[model samples]
Target: MADDDDLLGELLRFKLEAAGHDVTIVEDGQSALQAARSGKHDLMVLDSMMPVLSGPQVLRALTEEGSALPVVMLTARKGQDDVLDALSAGARDYLTKPFIPDELVARVNTILKNEGNRVASADH
Candidate 1:
């Protein structure tokens, strides 16, 4: 997760880890982009308002580099245009701030399940 707020990131990290996922928390987009490029994570949850590169910028960079890693963007921007911009920038899903943790977890699980299914089908 790329979030400048340590508390929020820690909360998310705890949740993901408790659910049996290895979580890495980065305070800025630069580190997040580096970690993503290293191909070490199965998925990424990014905060759109982070410093250094910003979420959309990181997403664009990843896409331009041909990385297929799925990214979920979190932002306080709830406007339609902001959400559309995130999707256009290659976010697999977008979540606004103050969202329910359970909802976020459910979305993450759904994305992972769907991705797993795709890989399984592709191998057939």
Candidate 2:
């Protein structure tokens, strides 16, 4: 996860870890980009605005590089364009801020589960 808010970051980390995910929290978008490029994580939960790089910029870079890593946008931007832009730019999901923690966990789980199924089918 990449979020500038320390409290939210820790809260999300706690919640996600409780959901049985091994979570890594980064405070900036540049760190997020570097981590994503490392090919180590299965999914990323990105905030729309951050220091160094915005969520959309990172998403675009990864898309341009043909990276298949799934990204979920967790941001305070509730505008239609924000949602549309992120989805069109290749985000797996776009979730607005002040969101229910449980909902986020559920969405993450569903995405991961679906991705697992896709990979399994592709291997056949």
Candidate 3:
């Protein structure tokens, strides 16, 4: 997870860890991109507005590198265009700022569940 805000990062880290997913918190986009490239994580929760590379930039890089890891973009910009832009850039989901933690968790769970089904089916 990459969030410039320390509190938000910590909260998300705790929530995810409690859900049995190991979480890594980074304050900037550069480290997040580096970590993503290492392919060490099952998914990435990115703040759309961040220092160094920005969420859209990171998403574009991941897409170009063929990293299929699911990404959920969090942003204060709730405009329809903004959401569409994130989706077009390969974000699996988008959440506006000040969102409920439960909503975030539910969305993450849904995405992971779908992904798990896809992988299991493919293995058959």
TM-score per candidate? 0.96, 0.98, 0.95
Tens digit per residue, CA lDDT, model 1, 39-88: 89989999888889998899999999988899999888799998998898
Model 3 lDDT, residue 34, Cα: 95
Candidate 3 off by > 4 Å: none
Off by over 4 Å in 1: none
Model 3 Cα lDDT, one tens digit per residue, 47-116 = 9889999988899999998889999998888989989988988999999999998789889889999999
**lDDT of each structure?**
0.90, 0.95, 0.90
**How far in Å is the alpha carbon of 97 misplaced in model 2?**
1.0
Deviation (Å) of 122 in candidate 2? 1.1
Writing each residue's lDDT as its tens digit, candidate 2 over 47-122 gives 9899999999999999999999999999999999999999999999999989999999999999999999999999
Stretch of 10 with least lDDT, candidate 2: 94-103
The positional error of residue 54 in candidate 1, measured at the CA in angstroms, is 0.6
